[model samples]
Target: MAIALTTLVAEAQRYLNADSISDYCPNGLQVEGRPNVQRLVTGVTASQALIDAAIEAEADVILVHHGYFWKGEDPCVTGMKQRRLKALLANDISVLAYHLPLDVHPDVGNNVQLAAQLGITVEGPLNPDNPRTVGLVGSLDEPQSARDFARRVHQVLGREPLLVEGQQMIRRIGWCTGGGQGYIDEAVAAGVDLYLTGEASEQTFHSAQENGISFIAAGHHATERYGVQALGEYLAKRFAIEHIFIDCANPI
Candidate 1:
């Protein structure tokens, strides 16, 4: 069976509470396509490769965590942007994307999903005072060495994360998926024994070392792969439509 494009977008926006959340890009439908959608394609980003893959898969809609028209990006659609939009427009494939809404959601958020993958029992947000905080503080069932916890992270993410070991064992943990290294200080203030995020800057190493809190920088793509998939599964099951998650791998 097929679902109307409007219905799918509306349901997704409602499910993720996209309207209330302010974000860099528009949350709900970025591009409109055919009136009805039978097959949905989901991915981490709406790159040209993912768009091509969706086209090959004959998808009626493409859902992603990253979509077009960012806050500071150039408004002109000239080269790469033109090509991507052309392909989607030519094939009648709608593009729906959510950013911060997908990261902070209590159920299918990237942070929550990553915690489930790593066997961490969630305690609360990294910053209690900030209701919009994307990072979360949690605890392992038992204490483990920083190295051992890094091993678990590597195993679950299928990539060797950059680890900055601290003085203590990893009991309390903090994490935010996809380019959340900026929140390291917030995690530190939360008093987590370890902090994990998608990417790290040079100063992040010093923060981990001087503050004596373990830090891990898993790949941005690796850490964020789950939420869109979970959201896709939820939508597919809800609307009784076919859904396929396409992972256009990024080494970084």
Candidate 2:
């Protein structure tokens, strides 16, 4: 049976727990597509390629991490913006986006799921004040060499992580999925032996070497793939609708 756009929007809202704050982009139903959606396509970024793929697949709705109307994006709907939205709007495909909420959701969150897969037991959020903080602090159940731990991360994530080993062993570690190298200081203050994140800044090498904390840069797209995929599967099981994850290979 096909699912109504309204029902799918509500389902995503409940799944992400996004009722508390003013989100930057329209959280659910950014662009109205078909009235009923039999297939829901999920992806990290709603790039033109993804939108075209979804349209070709006859997806009635698109779910993504990065949607339109980001904070710093231009307000004027022109160029690529107009093209992307026009395609979805023209086809009546609903767009549902979950950014930080998906990153922090306990069970299906990117950080939490990545930590669990890497054999790390998460203690709590790295940033206490912000509910949307994407970083988490955790401890490895059994301490291992930094190289061995990195290997395990590679095996679980299917990508070789760029690591800067520090002076200490890796019993405790902090991690944030998706280009969160800024949280290294938070990890250091939390007294974790290592910090793992997607993408690294030029200064990150200095930070790890000087701050006496190990740092690893796992691929951003690689690390963030888990949460949305898990969420998609959950949505499929919970609702009688089609859900497909479209992977856009991103090396950065």
Candidate 3:
């Protein structure tokens, strides 16, 4: 069954509550396409590979967690940007994106999905004072050594995580998906035994070591894979539309 493109976008916005979040890019309908959508493609990022896959699948809409037009980025539609837009326009496929909203959604959010993958029993937000913190603080159902936890992360995310060992056992921990190393400060403030995020910085290592909190830099694409898939499944169920999650591999 095909649903109007605008209707689909509105439904996504409602489900994600995209309007409430302060995001770097537009939250919905980044590129308009055909009036109706049947097959939908969901992915971590709207890269050329994903777009090509969408075209191959004959998808009318591409839903993603990372889209273009980021804040402070050069807005000129040239080179790579021109190519991506050209393909979308040429094929009449809409690209819809939600960044923070997708990360923070309690049900299908990136952090919560990662929590399930890592076997975490979430206690609350990583930022205690903020009710809507993007990162989460939680506990393992059973505590394990930092090394073992890294193994677990590898098992779940299909990528070996970079481990900065801290406590012998990790019970309570903090995590955010996709280049969220900056939130290590918040994790430290929350007094968790460890912090896990994608893509660690040089200073993150120093801070984690000094503060006695273990750190894990799981692959950015790996940790962020779930939210888009979860949201895609939900949309598929909700609208009776076909949704396929295209995993375009990214190492950082």
Each model's lDDT = 0.95, 0.84, 0.92
Candidate order by TM-score, highest to lowest? 1, 3, 2
As a whole number from 0 to 100, the lDDT of residue 156 in candidate 2 is 83
Give Cα distance to truth, residue 228, candidate 1, Å.
Answer: 0.5
lDDT of 3 at 123: 85
For each candidate, give its TM-score against the true structure.
Answer: 0.99, 0.93, 0.98
Model 2 off-target regions past 4 Å?
A: 129-132
Expressed as tens digits, the lDDT of each residue in 150-237 for candidate 3 is 9989988888899999865899999999989999999999989999999989999999999998999998999999999999999999
lDDT of 2 by residue, 1-252 (tens): 887778878887887887754666666657777788789899988989889999899898888877878888889989999999888888877788887788888998888888878888989989787665579998987888888888988898888999998867889998999989988887888888999999999999998899998889988888888888888888877887788999887787
Q: Of 2 and 3, which scores higher on lDDT?
A: 3
Which TM-score value belongs to model 1?
A: 0.99
Residue pair clashes in candidate 3: none
Off by over 4 Å in 3: 131-133
